[model samples]
Target: MAKPWFRVKRFGYGAGLPCAWQGWVVLAAHLALLIAASALLTGRPLPLSIVVITSTLGVVWIAWKTSDAPWRWRDGGED
Candidate 1:
């Protein structure tokens, strides 16, 4: 029997969002942490933004490379 659409797996995870809801949620939390950590470490906003943006971009790139679907979409077949 075939698996249900929602139960299909992709991108090393059970696919949801293009980047996966799991990745977006994790990235959001990581950004929040980066904000706090950079602020505490540098006592400045510029470095905080820079670090957060860089890290966020890196994560986004990784998510994009690992995902098989387009942004905001999902696929059921392995790619």
Candidate 2:
């Protein structure tokens, strides 16, 4: 059987935060860069795109932590 999307994201964690705020900071920066660049290049509504992407990453992080697969180091998929 194929691995589910949640399994593929198991390695998403890199830092251990003291609280949810810190965790969100890490996720926010990663997402902000992506959303900002995409918005600029595509001529989309920048602020709205940032907010939506940031929210989406937060939810994805939540689901990822709650999923059955164990947490693996976020190595950026590098060796």
lDDT of 1 by residue, 4-79 (tens): 1122244344334433465666667776888677768686777777777777777666565554444442344544
TM-score per prediction, in order, is: 0.43, 0.33
Cα deviation of 49, candidate 1, in Å:
1.2
Query: Which portions of model 2 miss their true places by more than 4 Å?
Result: 1-44, 71-79
Candidate 2 achieves a global lDDT of: 0.54
Residue 8's C-alpha lDDT in candidate 2? Answer: 33
Instruction: For residues 44-72, write the lDDT of model 2, one tens digit per residue.
Output: 56766776677767756764654434566
Which candidate ranks first by TM-score, i.e. highest? 1
Q: Clash totals for all models, in order?
A: 0, 0
Looking at model 2, the pairs that clash are: none
| Candidate 1: residue 67 lDDT (0-100) | 49
User: Each prediction's Cα lDDT score?
Assistant: 0.56, 0.54
